[model samples]
Target chain A: MRIPLKIGDAFVYGFAVVLVIISFAGMYLMGAKSDRRHVVIEMDKREIYSIEIHEGMEPVELRVDAGDGRYNEVVVMNGEVRIEEANCPDQLCVKSGAIRSSGQTIVCLPHKLVVRITGAGGEPSDVDDIAH
Target chain B: MKRYIAKACPMALAICLLFLPILQGCAINEVREHSKNLFALNTWINIRIYAGREGPKIIDSAVRRIEEIERRMSVTIKDSDVSRINDNAGIQPVKVHEDTFKVIEKALEYAKLSKGAFDITVYPIVQLWGITTEHPRVPTDEEIREKLKFVDYQKVILNEDEGTVYLQEKGMGIDLGAIAKGYAADEVVRVLREEGVQHALINMGGNVIVVGNKPNGQPWRIGIQDPRSDGVQQHIAVVEAVNESVVSSGDYERYIKDVYQKTGVRYHHIFDPATGYPANQGLMATTVVAENSADADALSTIVFVMGAEKGLGLVEQIGNAEALAVTVDKKIYTTKGFDRRLTVTNEEYEIVP
Candidate 1:
């Protein structure tokens, strides 16, 4: 069976195919951009460390001292960063579980400690504020 | 022909759907404006100002204003108004900056409103607890009682005409850690408004204040931190706001380490002036939403200390203010008016009807 195709139909089909290709390309680029996983630990607005979250890696526990006995124990395990222990009374840091997504942050205000997950350089350049 | 039209219609729709990202990208430059810094108020402050190209400059001025306020009010600074008041406690009344006088006046007003639940003159007791200092320790009942003698807000005599603040007691100290951040948020709002900024969000260490709605005319989502969660980002409730502040106080914000971890007793910074211990009326956290940030900041502590039942009543009594209390049992109770504005995200805590 032969089907007749009009010029309008041909235009529509070509446009649809082009649109799908562009959208997929855009999504792939975005996915790649967000794939660079790194978690940064900062105290008093100063960077203490940044570590890559490699999949299938053994759990690593890091103890950070904000001087004068203020300490936060950061744990990297199962592809996420979390505070395992902290000396601050409330343990708000420890309660803030693992964060794997970019732009997610765990702030221990008493110690002025911040654990932030980012994509490439630091927290995504896009988000202006993490209003919690 | 009709069948062909039907197929083309969906194809056209899909193409339009695919074009969304491009449209969003084009709109971004015109719509999104933000500025953030850590230098102001000794806390990380992030300002999202949705304005024209002037957003960045407005944010800079806002930060500068906050810094100026910090210099005026900080007790740590030797020459600050608060430092002078603390230094000259009972020695003499010290003149201060106009801003400092206004803040102290407002703090005193809150002290009267909450019946001393949110007293600024609790600095001596705060020092004794040492929650934020190097020598943090749970004070004995006797030590706390002795320090409580200086925790009277009535002793802080402010003469507005002379622009002087005097502490009546010899050893009285004043710390504005609770209310100053809120005042900073309000000042930033004022600065943004003066600069023709319509939409903005200013967060000074989680004392979030928003001026107007988002650039898109939607309410800004301010998350209430889960008091029980280990992650600070784990918000149990999300409240939409326009021209309001959301401030929370809990046992978690500042505390000496939980020495008896298994006993579940924690030595937090929020002290009850009457008892001179961490205000333990069985509240995990309290969030206040109000037009004035200072009220929100102070009431969060007031309500937390008062517990859920009395706290909710107090919030209701105060017009233009609402509160959410998270109890030690993991139950969430909000002011009657707050239910309409808040969306609870955590299932573990039931919202008290």
Candidate 2:
């Protein structure tokens, strides 16, 4: 029995294989994008800023004006975030130090400000929240 | 035959391409999370609901419920039920909302159970110390002693039939700082469950109450904050919880940092009603896990003030509740049932038998 061998059939098979590969690569990239960590800054429950954090990214400094002459200086570098300075009374946010892990937060009570790091892929520890 | 093969192969690829988006949509449907953040009761509150399109509306209702509770219970709110009761101390019984009455009634019960270890009438002492204020200081011994006179829970008179509260002494005040957040969390959980929400996480300033398992059918992992660590996410252990509340009372929450750095004495916020001073019990932090957030919230403070041995004893006596107490010496004492639920992640601390 002779198998049907035609150039047109080979072209069809090649196109099918290429289509499958492209779809898989698209799915893989989408998955990888969700894993990227982002720093979210919220003031009075409103998100004011957000930036994706990745390895070897350029350091960024943000001066958040919380009105009434109050301000918080946020520094994001090397995949970690910290409040470099703040005019708030407590200075607790500055003292919280650098937070790199997902679900971690630095809060300023006086300013009603919150800085949190979150990853869509979920944290390695899988912690939903910290009981303090 | 060759033409048929080519046509069939392209048709199959076209069919696969058409189904790709539907499969992705199914995967997205498995995890539907809607979260909202707000400030209430002098703390940050985060509510996440994993339900259908009604999640956002449910969260809005939950926030309104919290605000209502705060208005009735907050000491700082001028027209609040608590404020009215405090202002009328020794004058007459002030009618309060049922929520306020219920919370005070529950608080008094905890006070009686812990033998005054957790007293809501410690408000005068809390004001004197002002640890949560801008200028937290080490109050003089004389000042603490003066406020101690008004630090008795028995002075809070509750008329359940009238839904009223009165303080026997004019100087006495009631502050629900220790347990109000828990009540708020439980209220949120109740609302979520009633609205057909199967999975949710309600965090009222670290008083975490999880409703059911995660969307993926896994238990929620709640990190128990390490008392000695300054980082917000640092946890000595993680507890797997399902339809339960986890609350911790720790010296690390608020303190007089200047005094601590100078005198090596941490003037923290969790006060001992008996002494009108910060609880100097051997334990640095105490975590309570229970079916209700309010009970867990009050229990964490009771255990922290009572120390390790006595605290764990009270938890064991309660039967339904479990506690994890971390000593100043880095020793963790947990209830019998807690052993199976907790996984120690930090090696700096050791679990004691």
Candidate 3:
């Protein structure tokens, strides 16, 4: 048996292939950026320290003083940031647990301290505080 | 010929598919341009401005406006207007900028309303506690009691005509720490409006003042910082704010805890002028929403100091003002206006009617 080929059928097949190509191209162009974990610490509304998160890194402990006797202690281990302790009347930061994803922040208000994790191929998943 | 036309039709469609993403991307560019900047203004001033070609220019003007307020109002700055007023306490009356005079007058009004629950003249006690510095200590009762003598807002005499502020006693000092951020937020709003920008958000630390609806015409959602939030994104509630300011004052933000002593007492910076200590009104925090950020800022502190019941009463009395108070028991009480506007996200606390 002989098979007949139609130009219209060929065109429709070409259009389907082009659509898939375009969609994939768009997806590739918008694919996530580099995933680098960065732990940022802000005190009194200023970025005081930042470190890159990596595997096998020795545990780093940070003690921050807001100059008013308020103290915050933070621990970074195994690419996760945690508030180990704080002299704040409310130890909310210590209860905040270990966070590894971007946009997760452990905030100790008494100490005017904010430790945030950012950089995971996209913006951190924090509240959108557009209202300044 | 008909077959050829059918083939050409599909060919055209294929070409269209190739350029579809490019076309959509260009259309999205027509959305309003948003630009944000963060810098020091009393606190970390975070501002997001939305406009067209004038967006950058509008943001710059807003920054300048914030800096001017910070220069005049910041008590931390030794040469600021409030500092000069503090410097001349009892010795002489210091003339300040009209903005400073007006804010002092407003602070006095808040003091009168809360009956000194919120006092600008609590600086003497604030210095003794030094909650935000490295030397924060629970002062001796005699020391706090002595400083409490000067913690009278009524002692602050504001001469509107002369733009002068006078502290009645030698030790009396005025610290605008409670309401300065709100004033700064309002001033930034004024500048943004003057620049013809319709939509903007200004966060002076956690004092958030929003101007106009979002660029898409939706109301801006302002997160109420959870008093017990271990993380930044943890919000007890979110309010749909439109042309309003949402400010929260709480003991959690700046405090020194001495739990090791087993007294379980925490020393926070928000001083109760009457006691010369952190306000112990059974409230952990208060969030206020009002037309102006300054009012919201001061009222939040006042409400936190006033506790839940009286705070709700005052909030009800004030027009265009609403409040959300989190009690020591973790119960949330909100004004009728706020109860309707807020959406609670945290299940640990219950929002009361």
TM-score of each: 0.75, 0.86, 0.73
iRMS value of model 2?
4.4
User: Which portions of model 2 show Cα errors greater than 4 Å?
Assistant: A1-36, A100-102, A118-123, B1-31
Q: Which lDDT values do the candidates have, in the order given?
A: 0.79, 0.87, 0.77
- Cα lDDT tens digits, model 3, A51-127, are 88876788999888778677888888888888887777656678768877764556665566777766563334334
Q: Return model 2's CA RMSD, one decimal.
A: 5.2
TM-score of 2: 0.86
Comparison by TM-score, 1 against 2, better one: 2
The segments of candidate 3 whose C-alpha lies over 4 angstroms from its true place after superposition are: A1-127, A130-132, B1-42, B259-262
- Model 3 chain A: lowest-lDDT 10 consecutive positions: A123-132
- Evaluated with TM-score, which candidate comes out highest? 2
Query: What is the Å distance of residue B217 in model 1 from its true position?
Result: 2.7
Q: Chain A only: give the TM-score of model 2.
A: 0.73
Ranking by DockQ: 2, 1, 3
